[model samples]
Target: MTIFASYSIKGGVGKTALAVNLAYALREDGHRTLLIDLDPQCAAAYYFRIKPAAKFKFKEGPKLAGRLRRNIRESDYPGLDVLPSNMAYRNFDIMLDRLKKSRKQLRSILAPLAEEYDSVVLDCPPNLTLLSENIFRVADHLLVPVIPTPLSERTLEQLYQFFKEKKLPPNRIRPFFSMAQKSNRLHREFMAQLRLDYPVFLDTVIPHSVHIERMGQRRRPALDYAPGLAATQAYRKLCLEILKG
Candidate 1:
């Protein structure tokens, strides 16, 4: 499976929203997709109206695959399945730390799932940890959401620096503007600067819209609940851009 992680060092940058909609968009494009909620907040699962994953011990290879397979919950949408997160995931750092080659352990655990899925979307938690490092090692692409602002820009720089220090390929990280407001001068300026600095910035930008916030209330992808909305259209464009890459 091609693994795509929606990640950021800072929270509330629309990471989960991107994961949810992008997974749906992938499914809409006819790819068999699985969205794994790695975030302790479990917002992606909640968005898909999926139940929480049962607490289980983390094991290796086939054993670990069995545990994950048992928890797979089919979504209301066709071609999309969800592996919900539970509070047990908060202990991931402790679990991974005990394993050898911890930074690459997550890739091994997810390897077997490739046979069953065409794409895997991860909704990751904020902050850096061994688990985060494993995610960085495993994900085929890192979709980072940047809210056009000074603090968000600084966080993006920190992420790039971390990648440089770790010797991770910078091209693997794709940053895009989220919750952007064209009316705001600061937002426009920061976005322009970001584009000039990072030519890899995605062409599609997600706007700040109440409709997106309603995904929580509606418990569905925006494309499903608020069809033809600008936010939904933007997400579709982003999904296509991701696929093309």
Candidate 2:
């Protein structure tokens, strides 16, 4: 199974939106997809109308995987399941730190689900913590949603630097412009400059749209509620790009 993580050091850059929609898109394409909400906020799970997972005692590898498996809830949409996050997930870093191979423990924890899912999309929490490192180590593709701005650019650079310093595979990072405002000169400029500098950026750009922002109220992917909209089309295109890669 291919593991795709929607992550960023900076939050509010459309990370959860990407994860939620990507998982939906994958299921639409006939893949058995599992959306794992690692964020304690549980926004992804909330969007699917799934409640927060019950708190469970942390354990190593197989035990932890079983606990997570038990928490998996079938989404309203078929072929898509969600493993909602618990408030206790905030201690993931601490729990991972207790492992001998903390950076790689996530791989083992998630390995058991490989047989059941064709794709696993992770809605990761924002920050560069030990848990984030574990995510970096495990995810086949790290889908980073970068807004077209100086701050977002800097954070992307920081992410690359962290990968370099830690000797992680930077190639796994697939960044794309998120909440892009084509009308803004600076946004357009930054998008062009970053694409030129980082050839790895995805060609599909998710536009800043009210449809996307209303996901909280709609509690579903834009593709489901507004499939004809530009943002929804962008997400579908983005999913196709990742699948092609």
Candidate 3:
């Protein structure tokens, strides 16, 4: 299975929204997808109308996998499932610290799911913590949402530098413009500059839209409620780019 993580060192860049919508898109393409809400906020799960899962004590590998399995909830969309996050997820870094191969433990935990899922999309918390390192080690692709701005550019540079310093595979980082405003000259210029500098940036851009902002109120992916809209079409295009990758 391919593991795709929607992550960014900076929050409010549409990471969770990308994860939720991308997972739905993957399901629509006939892939059995599992969306795991790793953020303590559990916004991805909330989007799916799923409640926070009960937290459990971590044990051996089998037990841990069992716990994760029990927490998986079928979504309204066929071929898609959600493993909702809970407050206990805040302790994930601490729990990983206790493992022998802490930076790689998440990979082992997720390995068993390959037989059941064609794709696993993670809605990761925004931070450069130990847990973030673990995610970097495990995820096959890091889908980063970079807002077109100076600060966002610097943060993306920092992430690339971190990868170089830590000897992680930098090529795994696939960034794309999120909340892009074509009407804004700065946004357009910054996007052009970034694309020139970083050829790995996906061609698809997600536009800033009221429909996307209303996801909290709608409690579902834009494709579900606002299909045929530009924002929803952009998500589909992004998903196609990922699949092509």
Q: Count the backbone clashes (under 3 Å) in each candidate.
A: 0, 0, 0
lDDT of each: 0.90, 0.93, 0.92
Q: Write the per-residue lDDT of candidate 3 for residues 30-144, one digit (tens) a residue.
A: 9999999999999999999999998687544547667867899999998999999898888888887877888987888898899999999999999998889989998999999
- 198 Cα displacement, candidate 2 (Å): 0.9
Candidate 3, residue 153: the lDDT equals 87
Lowest-sum lDDT 10-residue window in model 1? 57-66
Report the C-alpha lDDT of model 2 over 1-245, residue by residue, as the tens digit.
Answer: 99999999998999999999999999999999999999999999999999999888866665787887799999999999999998888989888888898888888878888899999999999999999998999999999999999988899999999999999999999999999999999999999999998999999999999998999999998899999987788999999999899
Top candidate on TM-score is 2
Question: Residue 168 of model 3: what lDDT?
Answer: 99
Cα error, candidate 2, residue 133 (Å): 0.9
Worst 10 residues of 2 by lDDT: 58-67
Query: Candidate 1's C-alpha lDDT?
Result: 0.90
Residues 111-169 of candidate 1 have per-residue lDDT tens digits of 88889899999999998888889999999899999999989878989989999999988
Write the candidate numbers in order of decreasing lDDT: 2, 3, 1
* Preferred candidate (lDDT higher): 1 or 2: 2
